[model samples]
Target: MRIAVTRPEEDAGPLKARLEALDHEVVMAPLMTITPRASVHIPDLPWQVIAVTSANGIRALPPGHGLTSIRTLTVGPQSLKAATAAGFRAEAQGGDVNGLSAFIRAELTPAAGPILYLSGAETSGDLEGQLGAAGFACHRAVLYDAVPAAGLGPVDALLRRGEIDAVLLYSPRSARIWRQLTEAAGLSAQAGKLRNFCLSTNVASVLPEHWTRLVAESPDEQAMLALLAQKGRSL
Candidate 1:
């Protein structure tokens, strides 16, 4: 089966490699590109814990893995690797920011230590709200910015030719941007032709309204791959 891996480039490596290991032909088409924040600024002092939701945030950290001693809480497995590589002592990893918050609140609670959140410029989940309400002094550091994948001549051509089977969306931003690209490429309003499998319902809901079938995977990438493999077998 031919599967198109559609996360941002920095985040697509593990999933694409895993799919290939499973013997599925994978296409690594990133729907977004992550670049470090040109206006670079990370706090001078370290925090008790650091939160990482995207691998981009990990890769974009300023020179010298500043988060060496900080206990890093990550959102997913792929981010875990990036976080560890960036020198954070990953204490725990969750499926998403919501889950990561839950874990952090449970594990590190009622403490006066500063909690720093490493994220993109635009964040979907309210990590600060959740963590703040739980009594953690959460500070957010925007390490990267996510940009849309424009000039999609190949993806557009593939959809028009009906050669693409499905699209895997890792975030709501990706879903929204890809929907626009698809419509701009004249691929929208074609329901039931290309399946949409998203990381969760929130991601799926952002998809174009014309697509009637959108499958939601569990919050984790392993679960997403499992569900994808299941669908592959069913096909």
Candidate 2:
């Protein structure tokens, strides 16, 4: 099976490895690109916890933060790995920001400490504001932004050849861009020729009107990958 990974490029390597590990060929057709936002500030703060949603955010962590200084929560395993590599240890993880918010409301808010969020400049989740409204003061550190990737060279050829077996989508931005890329790349005529549409929940909801949406039970790659494997590229 040939899988088209539509995550932004920096994140594409691991998904490609996962597909290859599963014995599928991965076409790295990253529909979106992650561009670090210039002039984004990383606050030097004594905080409650650092919440991270994407590895890109973790990768964008600033210079002065130490691993043991604060508790950390990540939205997914990939971000956790990146956080670890960035020298931030996650004291709690697993839930998306919603669950993390619930956890904070239950546990951290009572501690009455400040929190810092390491996040993309144009992020999907707003854990800080939500937590703030719910009575927690969280400082945020904006790190990166995602824009459409450039030059879909072989993607055109692959679509023309009808070679894509699965379309793997991670974010709504990517999903919308996938539709745009397909149309701009002139692959709309090949609709339904795709064997499956594997996407995380938010991404699935935003897919073009024409694409079949296979929902992952959760937003993590493991969930999407599990859905992709179990659904057997026939969605």
CA RMSD, predictions in order: 2.0, 2.3
Tens digit of lDDT per residue, candidate 1, span 1-235? Answer: 6666778766777777887888877767787788887767777664887888877878888886556786777887777887777677875466888888888888786574888888888887999889999888888988787887775646666666677777787788877887787777666854236767778888888875567445645687777777777777766
Those runs of model 1 whose alpha carbons end farther than 4 Å from true positions after fitting are 209-217
- Give one digit per residue, the lDDT tens place, for model 2 in 157-224: 88888777778777777777777777777787674466445445676667655666788887677787
The reply for model 2, stretches above 4 Å from the true place, is: 65-68, 233-235
Against the reference, the lDDT scores of all candidates come to 0.76, 0.71
Candidate 2 TM-score, true structure as reference: 0.88
Question: What are the clashing pairs of model 1?
Answer: none
**TM-score, per-candidate, Cα-based:** 0.91, 0.88
Compare the candidates by lDDT and give the number of the best one. Answer: 1
TM for candidate 1 is 0.91
